[model samples]
Target: MPYSITVNGAVREVDVDPDTPLLWVIRDNLGLTGTKFGCGVAQCGACTVHVDGQPRRSCALPVSRLGNRQVTTIEGADGPEAKAVQAAWAARDVPQCGYCQSGQVMSAIALLREVKKPDDKAIDLAMNGNICRCATYVRIRAAIHDAAKALEA
Candidate 1:
């Protein structure tokens, strides 16, 4: 089946099975490999992306289910919040294996977008689903706070 989906402001037509995970289409067909596939199930946030500005797990999202909604991957996150998050992650040295950083950053950007100055509780709730095997939770929390500060600056 050929499904037309808009990704990162570009409309693309990809031919694949309807049930094919959007992650594969984005990575294999569109050649956008920034979104990692950690678990294939929605359990891990490695394939997190924005579907109409809301973060979603692409690994389990079927391409056919994506109608006219816009998909934004890490490559599309260039807003002030994303920039701050990126800088904060770098400043805090958050990533350990670096495999899950893309999803972590995406989730962090979404969290900051919703809560300007998120408290630890808010951050915990928003980031609860994203699992970093390196257990960089401390640094992740610190980076989120730093990103909030950066946004305030």
Candidate 2:
């Protein structure tokens, strides 16, 4: 069946199996590779995306699970919030391996949207599942803080 999903900001019609993961559909069908596939399960936040403004693990999220909800991937993640997060990520040098940055940035945008000024504990709680093998947690936290500050001002 063909599923009409709103990805980024455009409504794209993808003819794929209902059980197919959103990550694959976004990558293969949509030709958007910003969302990574760290783990097929939801344990890894590598395939994190915004589903109706919520951070979702796209790797495990079935295409059927998404309806009219707006699915925002790294490619489609824009606006002042995304720019702030991107600026913070660059300023703090958040990525080491560069594989997890997109997911991390997506997660951070979600976190910042919810918690305008997230503290260490809040950041930890929000970014708990997203793992970085390069161990850039410190910088990620700093970038989140910086983004919050920039958004605050």
Candidate whose TM-score is highest: 1
lDDT of 1 by residue, 1-153 (tens): 989999999999999999999999999999999999999999889999999888899999999999999999998888899999999999999998998899999999999999999999999998888999999999999999999999998
Clashing pairs in 1: none
TM agreement with the true structure for every prediction: 0.98, 0.97
TM-score of candidate 2 against the unseen true structure: 0.97
Residue pairs with colliding backbones in model 2 are none
lDDT of each: 0.94, 0.91
lDDT of 2 by residue, 27-58 (tens): 99999999999989988799999999999999
Candidate 2 wrong stretches, greater than 4 Å: none
